[model samples]
Target: MLAAATAAVLLLFLVALVMMAAAAFAFAVLMLMAVP
Candidate 1:
């Protein structure tokens, strides 16, 4: 039971990390387009 909970938490962390990375990438693209 503990292992399963740990796994779920890890998965959630990974998803959050990916989302943050995607947001950063999108922001960078928008800045590039605005500047040029």
Candidate 2:
């Protein structure tokens, strides 16, 4: 039971990390487009 809970927490952390990375990437792209 403890292992399952830990796994779920890790999965959620990974999802959050991926979302943050995607947002950062999108922001960078927008900045580049606006610069030119």
Candidate 3:
């Protein structure tokens, strides 16, 4: 029971990290395109 709860929390954290990474990447691409 505790292990399952921990796993679920970890999974959510990983998903949030991935989403943040993707957003940063997309923002970088847009900035690069705007520069020139």
Candidate 4:
């Protein structure tokens, strides 16, 4: 049971990390477009 809970937490953390990375990438693209 403990292992399962830990796994769930890890999965959530990974998803959050990916989302943050994607958001950062999108923001960078938008900034580039606006500047040029």
1-36: candidate 1 lDDT, tens digit per residue: 999999999999999999999999999999999996
Q: Which runs in model 4 stand beyond 4 Å of their true positions?
A: none
Candidate 4 vs. true structure, TM-score: 0.96
TM-score of 1: 0.96
The sequence of per-residue lDDT tens digits that candidate 4 reaches over residues 1-36 is: 999999999999999999999999999999999996
In terms of lDDT, model 4 sits at 0.99
**Candidate 3 backbone clash number:** 0
Each model's RMSD to truth, in Å?
Answer: 0.4, 0.3, 0.3, 0.4
TM-score versus the correct structure, for each prediction: 0.96, 0.98, 0.98, 0.96
Computed on alpha carbons, the lDDT of every model, listed in order, comes to 0.99, 0.99, 1.00, 0.99
lDDT at residue 4 of model 4 (Cα atoms) = 100
Worst 10 residues of 1 by lDDT: 27-36
Of 1 and 3, the candidate ranking higher by lDDT: 3
Cα lDDT over the full model 3 = 1.00
Candidate 2 all-Cα RMSD: 0.3
